[model samples]
Target: MKSVVANYMISRKWLLLALVILLILLPFVLSDFRVNLLGRYLAFAILVIGLDLLWGYMGVLSLGHGIFFGLGAYIMGIHLKMEASSGGLPDFMMWSGMTELPWFWTVLQHPVIAILAGIIVPMIIAVILGFFTFRNRIQDVYFTILTQALVMVTVTLLISRQDVTGGTNGLTGFSTIFGFSLSDPATQRVIYYVTLGCLVIILLICSRLINSLFGKALIAIRDGENRLRFSGYDTSMFKVLVFTISAGIAGLAGMLFVMQVGIISPTQIGIIPSIEMILWVAIGGRGTLIGPVIGAILTNSAKTFFSESYPDIWLYFLGAVFVIVVIFLPGGLMSLGKKLKRRNSNEKGQTNSKADYSAS
Candidate 1:
């Protein structure tokens, strides 16, 4: 058992090294357009990692992560809009007949504050929602439904307050970030690099977390909540903490997404996108750190290709992919690699046993 564990750890280290090398080399190899697209996908990868942590490990399925993601995007969006406005009311607000910025918008003028708020606001919201729901022992489908409702409520609020949130049009017309012209290719590359760095940092944080005792508790809660509770652990608190942490991670992803995409619209924060986020995690092996990144990149690449080449049938293609993954690869696409490795290990073990017998 010890040898087996050691071998698995060694394999994981090699896999991690390979991933790091590929990511570092990708910018040099891919075209500017492709790199930008990858930046967007990496942001999505970050979002799905948080979702995987919650749903895959803690057994908490939240269909409303879009709310947290959008909130974070809007935080950055407001700052960009403010910068573009040049101390005047934002274009959307002016169009909506508002003479002044809203009180909340005033605070976002500072980029640092906005970025920090982008992460913290979602975490606070998650804590509040999780605290009440978990304390009440809302689990499984009911919890999922609640999260879906959160998406609806958030979308409605943003749309109704068009003057503040830019309404259905959402936030756009971002000219610069911290005085750097977004249109400049160099600036774009810098943003992409920053996004890549953030993803790497988030992956490291999650890896550390999942290997810790807290992670074991989360898995315990997933596998047997009642058993864990009977073991004298406050399962509710554990769930709430993990949920809040996941939301914070999603927020960070959203911030990076807005930077790369240069837009944050209500459409992106709706039920469909939220469901798609879940699908990314599902298609990737949940409970596996690297799986969500693979799922997001591959799934989005396919979506982009099909949407452009076969626009009318892209949805169908996506639906088929999800169905196939669910039915045939429930352990997700990553499981195939694991299986092959196990097979090779077993073959080597058999060869060693034969050699020993022959020696005897």
Candidate 2:
């Protein structure tokens, strides 16, 4: 089994290397607009990876990942808005009739604090949620429903707090980040590279984690939580740890997204987008690290193309794609590729065996 796994990795390594090369070359070859889109898609890819880790490995489906994502984005957004306003009220705040910066927003003026809060805040939320849910033995559909409710509550709160959160508009108009003008092409390129680097780092970390004994424990929990519990493991603790890590990763993705997209809104943190995040993981093989990245890029690219070409019919097309993937390609596109490769290898072996028999 180890040998087979090693061989599989060896076979896939070239493809991984090619992908890295393509990412590195994309900014150089594509127009600025296209590069920006790629950067945004990469951010989504990071979110999908975290979702895959949670749902695919641990069997803990969360439809509320957007809350963590939005929290992180808002943290960075607050910092950028504060910076842009030069320590005064953000534009939305002024428009909403705010006289002074909110006390909570003051400490986030420091970029370092904002970034740390972006990651740490989400993890803290995840820890609290996980503690309650897992301790109460919530799993499967109940857990999923709870997450859905969480997203709804978060969106409602953000939308209602017009003065504090900018309401429907959220936050935007970030001119510079840490002294670099966002409008500068060089700055955009640097941000794109930084996002790509972060994605790669997160992928590496997840890859190592999933291959470890802890990852095996996660799988065991996924397969049989009760059995694992009976085997003398603190399954709740594991669940909380994995869930917090997943939220932190999502938060990191949100920060990268805000840097590239320049806006963080409640709309993006709502139920539909959260569901789309799950589709990204499912359409890619969930258990596979690279699959979610491919799914995110392909699915979002398709959505962009279809929505541009046929805005009214894009939803039907997307629904059909989801249906077909669920019905026919249950293991996802990556699994299909693996199946084809194995079939071809088996056929070649059979042909070689026939030739040997003929020679004998």
TM-score of each: 0.93, 0.93
lDDT of 1 by residue, 260-298 (tens): 889999999899999999889878777777887888888
Which segments of model 1 are wrong by more than 4 Å? Answer: 340-360
lDDT of 2 at 257: 94
Whole-model lDDT values for every prediction: 0.86, 0.86
Cα lDDT tens digits for candidate 2, 1-360: 577668878766666677878999989889998899899999998888888888878888899999999999999999999889899878788788889888879999998999999999999999998899988787567878988999999999999999999899999999999989998888989989988898888888998999899999988888888999999999999998988999999999999999999999999989989988888887887777788888998899888888889998988887887788777776677778666766797878843222110100
Best by lDDT: 2
lDDT of 1 at 146: 92
Minimum summed lDDT over a 10-residue window in model 1 is located at 351-360
